[model samples]
Target: MDVPEEHSYERVKYIPQNFFETICNDNPDDFETELKKVIFSHVDASEKLGQKSLEELIDYKSQVLLKDITLFQNEGGILNKDIIDLEKKRTATYRKSIEEGLSNKKLELANHQSNKPKDVAKLESNGDYQKSIDEEIKYKRAEKEKLEEELNLATKKKSEQKIKQSNLERISQAIDTFQSQYEKLKTDNEPFLKTIGFKFEDAVQVHIDKNAINTLVETVKIKIETLSDSIKPDNENGLAFKIIKLGEEITNLQSKLDEPTKRYQTYLDDISKWEQREQELIGAEDIELTLKYYEGVLIYLDNELENDLAYKREQRKGVVSQLHEKKRAILEVYKELYKPVTGFLEQYKNINKDYEITFDVSFRLKDFEEKFLNYVNQGVKGTFYGNKEGTVTLKQIILETDFNTLEGVIEFFDKIIICLERDRRPGQGNESREIQSQIKNGFYLDMYNLIFNLDYLVPYYELKLGGKSILQLSPGEKGALLLIFYLILDQDDIPLIIDQPEENLDNQSVYNILVPFIKHAKSNRQIIIVTHNPNIAVVCDAEQIIHVSISKTQDNEMSINSGAIENPSINSSIVQILEGTMPAFEKRELKYTLTKNNMHSIPV
Candidate 1:
């Protein structure tokens, strides 16, 4: 059954990789339905048949419903216009909202300007001023200064008292130091009570046991008496002179002993009196004097403290009173300022509540209205005319609708169109050549979309390797493209053999799409390809190779013989060979096949 040629230019239904799954579910019960009913039915069926594989069922369903696989239609191409229309409407809506927001801001600013002076007056210098209050504040500050001076005077008095107390303490310490030193020296040189002479106790004890000193004293006294009596009896004789001399010497000795005894007794009595006085002072007098001195100082300090403390209390009371007055003045001023503003601002706030209505309701409504109009216009254009050229120009609508930013939109799309046009005609001088180049480029781009964009090779739920882009295709995509390439190359449906089909592919990506590749294309298709890598060759069967070569003739010339190698080993050939003349080899196939032949019938 041939398709009508007039209908050839009509939009072709692009069967997306997921079309089978979508359609089978959509038409599960009936092959055709009302347009609306069909859409609902498809949506419903996809949801219902959650676990079933649509790709698996597509083959059977295609046979039953659509007789020809290539003749089937897809709804996505027709939906592109609707998508573009909806996007335009949405964009207009956004733009309208932005315009509304700007208008609201402008309205807010205008309201703010109207109320600016009132707000400033509420906070101005004279707004809360009172002459009496200022005078009272000045008076209170003067009072506070007077009180501060009094406090300073009291502090000075307290400092003087502290200094006097420190002096008294130093005097008491000096007296204690003298007393301790005198006591320590007196103890080291103490006099004995029993001894008449100034002798240490150990020296006196040594003489007491021996009577050497007493015997000497007694012998001297006896001699002195005898001399005295002899001197009286023999006054007329020569012995009288000797007696008189002895008498004078005895008197002199008596005088010396008498003075020393009296002095020694006096020293002993004085020492006893001094020791008794020291004990009396330590027991009562010392404590009494010390207590009396400190008590006097403390009394003097208390007197000074009483004066200073009284002065400080008086000053603090005045200061506190002044602080209260100042605080009252400040509060009065605050009341004056706040009282007026509170009423004025309360009303102002109520009036301005909508003034600050941040939402640009006016502009927003305007924008939405404009957007709605544009959307309606675009919908009409899309639904009825299927044209966007001039049925309702956005510029005319923008100018008449008074939109501020429609020009920006026009400019943006204009730039995009310009860029597309430039890209379309890149890298050429002549217009036709440029157009041809662009067509070629478009074909290349379409090839990218067709092979890579078809996501059945990477189903949504299935796992996929990372870093996958059209530019970075997995081996499976490349192989599929190669299959497509070969299919296009051999439009007559001849079998194809591709060597090293996936030479530079990553392993994980290859594994992820291998199943899809086999299922979609390789499973039902006849393809033969060679690979040095075992990934492809290991999986393949039924391969043949022909190795051929040419050698110099025995008479210094060359000959050719070439034939198919029935079974070629991985390393070398055994079964068959090729023989041929020396020829120019340009491509991989040529490099592989072209060779010179020798005179002998040995295959090259």
Candidate 2:
């Protein structure tokens, strides 16, 4: 059966009283007849199954229309019936205006014809009068030709004036743009100049020559005037040619201005580099003094000829005391920072039962101590302490280890001090060798300094989930987990439209896990799912179903049928198409089994 067009039908539950009252206000008999004709013309026997006669069908259609109109009024604040009435009034008013205009034109034409001269035949019969009339006609024709020539010349002059006015406006706009750019350039560069310790005015003068800019502007003005004067009314090139040439000159001037701006940027970059170099030089001076002081103390400890050993030992003890205090402070800070990581791991373990995860933060001092001692033990007795034996093994020096106590961290620093003092003995000629090169190139003292620097050396926090890092999870598992996390944590009262949430999920997972979650979630928010899955529609007990079908007619025009499941025909079609013919009958039998008989004679 062919369905009626969607536009001609409205799905409404009830009709309002105002609709009937309005219909009755008009000719009730004619209105009912017309409404019945419209209803019968579109609806077929299938659609009229529940109705008995034409009047009942008309009443049903009227209820639908009245419900639609009421909905329209509620949404758009304008009644459909009132709109129709206004449109009728408007059409009548327009028709009356056109009729009145036509009548006035006809009356005026009749009066004009009555007032015209009726002596044309008499004038034609008299030869003298005819000759005089012909002469008057010739004179008028000559005067008209002269006036036409003057009008053509005036129009040409007006057109030329318009072209000149447009060119002037373009020039004015270009000047305004140039002025704005100049002011913005100056403002943008002011802060950069101040940052680099140059006066803004001085930098502007040095980089952007004002005199040159003024000269360029003046030259452009002269060129504009020269081109304007050269524009002739009959010139084939036209004003467009002059305007293009003006634009080219302005572009050239802009290119010239760009050079100074580029130079200013270069100057700012150079200043920044020089300031960084100055900071490096200051740091180098402090490092030089520190190395010299350390060298002097080592020399005092080594010699018994120049100084008392007790005084040197006392000074060394004082330095060691301070180093111990710094070590304690570093360990305290590391423990405090490690608390958050432990708390997060505890929470993660509680939530994710299937995954076994562990996290720990501890200082890596034992690792550094082992590496440093290995380097010292492998060193030769002479030749700058390691020049003969070569350098320490890189793999050995970069080991990862954790320490539980502050005493272990302190003991690690003591080993590093002993190694450095032994390398700097007086007879070894170590003072002549660059201290930085010796430390960095051979044993990598910078690595040791990094370990010593409290800000640089913090505790390492390691994480593992299900005996494997999170990065080790397969891509599909990761995607599923991320989706589950978002759904569980980020609940909000917004409609979530998920297209095929069961795409990669197994059938069991959809029926047991996803369906229940969606059912619970729908209680708090609306969800619109577009799917081909029958379980999602039937098992979820969806409140409304829009069964949509597309087909093409013989004319090759596309037709779309969309209706709600509340309609028995639509509901049956959805079941037949989505769940197969057998399931549809099973559903029907479940509903009407008690009243039905066995159909043994019916063919499958």
Candidate 3:
């Protein structure tokens, strides 16, 4: 209400961002329309026009009108209904002033048109220009005064412009220095980032995308990790893909070997049965000849088929060896990749420093075991095994196992993922091919990102106030801190009406902590609170004491009695209410006497 230097919509952005949402949620049902208008005043978003709310109000780059816009100030802070209403009031005042000016202009124009001929006649008649000498001089002096005011305004503007230019120069120099240092940091870190991936993109994306930096990072990480599953077996790739194809080839050979082996065994059995029955046959000679012929055919078959089986087995063995070689090569690649990370971790650990963002964030590089265990314990929501009810999980095994190295931990995770893929994949179709997945262990956790390489972690964003996290602080302590922040640190001079400051505080706590704070805070802003403690009200010497009584029987009528402690009636009311009655108050007064240093107890 007091500050009208800026537009109400713009000024409202100064308020805490959450306060807007809270107030909107609390708004009456009928004011829903007004709430929407208030929200849109900051960024009028629509399907057709996008969000160019202030396009009409603000000229973009002094030329182009922005068609799409989003609020970037104060993390998307905007006007509320109250601010919009205030803006409306200001607009109405401006419109009234403009209308008045137009009316005055019309009247002045009419007077000028009517008096023009007379003015001309006066000017022609012996140089009598419709004014006395004194009046004409007064008129010239008034004109000179207006011109002087304009000149003074121009001089003031010139001085202000020079100051602005000087400030801009300093700012520009600081910006250049910042960019130089940032480029150097990136250059120093370039080598470490290249081991896991060939490409390097920004760690953060556009701020306007609400789900930008972290979300995009996670999405890209998942896609990169799961990229192997997406690739068809027909797709040509390196060692991993070759290993899968060789595995399938060996499996086919194993199946083909079973056919030849089974057929050769059947042929032997028939020849043996024929030999056994030949001696007892009526046509012994013919049977013996048949057996001999069959035996000879079996000999030929054994020679050809045995050679074929041996050749097939040898070929499968060669494929298996190749598969093993590919696997070993991959392991070697993994070791090479891990060296940079391990080195990065060691370097990061050796250095000790705190990097501050908008909040207090502490980061430390987690070792192989610590990082692996944390992720596994938290659970992996893999393609085959998800972190859901009844889902096959790594958590159980993770809790049981004590990991020694990153390689060993990853090997175990790879086995688990491989087993899950094999179990879940169906036979004889494209679905089975996903078993050749590339994501192994913690690679999905932005494996190539420097943060991953360093294995730096904060666990969660532990925002601390006074070196204590919110989780560590009790409700009273949290409230107290918030109150202190609002009163002392926030410094906005916004009205703070604390409903029961001593709600959770004990009497001693109120006196020791809150009483002194409120006393000091009162000098800055009025501290209004609903408190019943005599130590707070009486000791602090309240400027006003209000005795409120609610009568529910009489249509919930509220009666308020207000006065200072100096007033007899107010003092009596305070004693009666706070001390439970005048008799009890007098009894307490007789027992205890107030003093500067300490209250003394009288002997009973």
Index of the highest-TM-score prediction: 3
Query: Candidate 3's residue-wise lDDT over 81-129, tens digit each?
Result: 2222222222334445545544554454455445432111112212233
The TM-score obtained by model 1 is: 0.16
Residue by residue across 1-604, what tens digits does model 1's lDDT show?
9766974653322223322233334542221222122122223244324424333333223332332211111222223233333333223343455455445544544554453322111111122333333334335434544543444454445455455545655655655665665555345445543255553443423212225444544554555454444335455442444434444443343334334343443444345445544443333221333323334434434455445534543443333333333333333332332232234223323322321111010111123223222323222212111134323333343345321133432343333223222332224321211111222322433321221111111111111122232224444553433333222222223344554445444554333433234323344445554433333433332244333334545555444332333333532332111112123213434555544323344656
Better of 2 and 3 by TM-score: 3
In model 3, residue pairs whose N, Cα or C atoms come closer than 3 Å (at least 3 residues apart or on different chains), thus clashing, are none
By summed lDDT, the worst window of 10 consecutive residues in model 2 runs over 12-21
1 versus 3: better TM-score goes to: 3
Q: What's the CA error at residue 494 for candidate 2, in Å?
A: 1.6
Show where candidate 3 strays beyond 4 Å.
Answer: 1-468, 532-535, 553-555, 593-604
Task: Give the lowest summed-lDDT range of ten residues in model 1.
Answer: 356-365
Model 1 misplaced regions, further than 4 Å:
1-492, 506-525, 543-604
The list of candidate 2 runs beyond 4 A from truth reads 1-473, 530-539, 545-604
lDDT of each: 0.34, 0.45, 0.42
